[model samples]
Target: MASITLNKLVKRYGNGKTVNQVIHSVSAQIDDGEFVVVVGPSGCGKSTLLRMVAGLEEITGGEISIGNRVVNTLEPSERDIAMVFQNYALYPHMNVFDNMAYGLKIAKVPLVEIQARVDKAAKILELGEYMQRKPRELSGGQRQRVAMGRAIVRQPQAFLFDEPLSNLDAKLRAHTRLEIQKLHRELGITSLFVTHDQVEAMTLAQRMMVMNAGVMEQFGTPEEVYSRPATTFVASFIGSPPMNLLKNAPDARPGTIVGIRPEHLDITATGWALRVDALEMLGFERLVYGRWLHGAGNELVIVRSDETQPVPGLDTIIHVTPRADRLHTFDAATGKRL
Candidate 1:
């Protein structure tokens, strides 16, 4: 219901010269009711940033504001925010209903009000029938739903999800992703989800904040991030097979790095000749992996081929072409976009 602002946030540990600064002067404005995912690789400080916003990690410098109120010194309990952790954190002895209602019970919300909220959340989450089931009786997806339901019952200003879907299997993860999208539409709650998975970031985020080593690499729509990555890290990390970073390109300007996604490449009579080294079939499509024969094939490039296309034998030379507009250029020295 309110916009969250992180103004030059910083996090560090230890004292003086021995200090390890993990998060560095991060700033972002998350609009009200926006589902923004903070995505990055492991040790990139995505979770640490989320924790700072949730008031779980103390900000070493800068201010955090929720709905115009600065919450820098506020305790986690007083932040008026609900956090759904990766672990679900459901009490094994309690039923789903109890798990969702415990926070309200602690806050001394009216029992009728608590019941109404929990019931509404359970219904929204399609968890009505599982209300009496304990954590032990539920599957991974259901337990994750219970965690979401607990947050929903709080009806806080915003929701902070820390890899809420990490534990689910592929099918369940996909299903629950749709469930989350529906839940967000129904409730219109402001949310910040943290994940290392770019797939989740692409599917779930309205605007994604890409972080790398405590610095925000880019903040934009999924399409913008994909089509025009801000740096080599963003270019390489956002895609599935990742963008092929062509280092020391024969034709590129000095210190320039070229990047191209696998899908954008085509098997053509013209263009670069890639030395076919490997292939991986992924049902509908195949991944052709090889190096550019002319340029020393220093880094393996991947090209997605449809099932209809014939798979070539290894060691066979494959000529590849890249879509002209799909080319991404960055500085080899700083890795920043050129």
Candidate 2:
């Protein structure tokens, strides 16, 4: 495993005035044996960034270093990185063992060494019994595991995943996530995973880079990103229900927006009056969507109430208090944390 570094990376399509710049000057240092997730919505340049690092996309400017070597001009095979894509990309005609060992075979590795490597990968991925099975016979999760096993056999300096779990069902995705976590724990390989799912990003990442519109909005641990979002875009995008940003909030300062998470608001007898618009039951907890009564614009606010709390009726007026310490302040014009 080796460290990966992106120094002022840039990517542009077309030339002259028609040039479309997708990736801005993004830079981040990924430590050796660390798992970093690059997460964002589609067309946000997250995949583009990953492809750049994988040497699949040409860099318009700046340098990409894998370990001690600068790999800007290197071919994808020469970069010593293994990429697991969204598609399984397995050979239907070949069995799991042959699929996993194909690259090593092409590289002219000894038959004994190829068998050893494929066996080790199959054992790691729990595919020992299905080594002779074709891709058509395997389940989706198993096929994904085969794809991963193929990469593992390469034993590259780093692993790059481009939405590898997107094709699976919810349960399979969750299960595969655990398998991936276990794989990382055992191998300790440097991994850069790209995904649009926030849950995947939060759960799998040692550190996550949140990107938007080709710009990296924030880069930090999941805890840091959730607890202290640097900008309004991040504040709104990172959470489940997302942080509520109210422009016309009570006791508001000029040109500032008050941001609060649903869970941080306490339903109280006296505070900000909220007229309940809707209520969503989520097993152990309920989400109360309401409009602030006092504000001129009647901005919407959501409050999370646990099973211990009473569920409020629709159109009923309920008071909720925002925790002073938990409130986030952002500059309304710039959408940046203040």
Candidate 3:
């Protein structure tokens, strides 16, 4: 395992007149054996950042160092890093064993050592039973495991995952997420995962970097980022139903907006009255969407509820209250946390 560091990293396209600067001056340190996730919406440059670290993309400025070596100029193969892409890039004609052992073989590792490494990786990935199966014969989850197994044998200094679970169904995605967590716990290799899924970031990362339109918004633990979001975009982006932005609130400062999460709201008899407009039943929990009474612009707010709790009917008026201390304040003009 090795520590991964990025200092003032930058990426741009074209040059001069048509130059489109994507990734800004981003910097962060990923400690040895730590799993860091870079997350954001599409077109946020999350993948671009990962590829930069992997040496697949050129860095227009700054530096990326894996362990003690500056890798900005190193070839992908020379960086001592392994990447698992979104699409399980396995050879359809190769059996599980060969696919996993192919890299080692190409590197000229002794056949005996390659066998040992493949066996160990297969066992760890629960792919021992499928070693003889080709990619076409295995399930989606199994194919993904083969991809992971291929990376595992490399035992690279770091692992780069670009939405490795994106191709799986919801249940398989959850299962693979647990498998990944277990793998990281056992291997404890430095890892960087990039994804647009907030839930994945929240569950898999020791510390996560939140990106927005080529800029680094916040870098912190899932708890820190979720509990005290660094920006309005984060407040709105990180949560399931997102935070309620009392845009143009009567009492808010001219350029600041008040933020409150769905789960932080309560139905009270004495608080602000909300007219229920919609309901989303999510098994054991429910989400109530309503607009504030006596407020203009149809500004909606969401309130999370337990299945056991009763919710108001649509168009019914119910009072909702926010935990004052949990309120987030952000600059409406700049979207930065205030």
Predicted structure with the largest lDDT when compared to the true one: 2
TM value for model 1: 0.95
Clashes of each: 0, 0, 0
State residue 10's C-alpha deviation in candidate 2, in Å: 0.6
Instruction: Note the residue pairs that clash in candidate 1.
Output: none
Identify the runs in model 3 with alpha carbons over 4 angstroms from their true place.
none
lDDT of 1 by residue, 119-216 (tens): 99988888999999999999998899999999999999999999989999999999988888988998899999999999999999999999999999
User: In candidate 2, residue 191 scores what lDDT?
Assistant: 98
lDDT of each: 0.91, 0.94, 0.92
Which TM-score value belongs to model 3?
0.95
What 10-residue stretch in candidate 2 is worst by lDDT? 292-301
TM-score of each: 0.95, 0.98, 0.95
> Which prediction has the highest TM-score against the true structure?
2
RMSD vs true structure, all candidates: 1.6, 1.1, 1.6
> Could you tell me how far off, in angstroms, the CA of residue 207 lies in candidate 1 after the best superposition?
0.6
lDDT by residue (tens digit), candidate 2, 1-338? 79999999999999989999999999999999999999999999999999999998999998999999999999998999998989989999999999999989988989999999999999888999999999999999999999999999999999999999999999999999988999999899999999999999999999999999999999999999998999999999999899999887887798999999999999999998889999999998899999977747467898998999988999999999999998999999988999
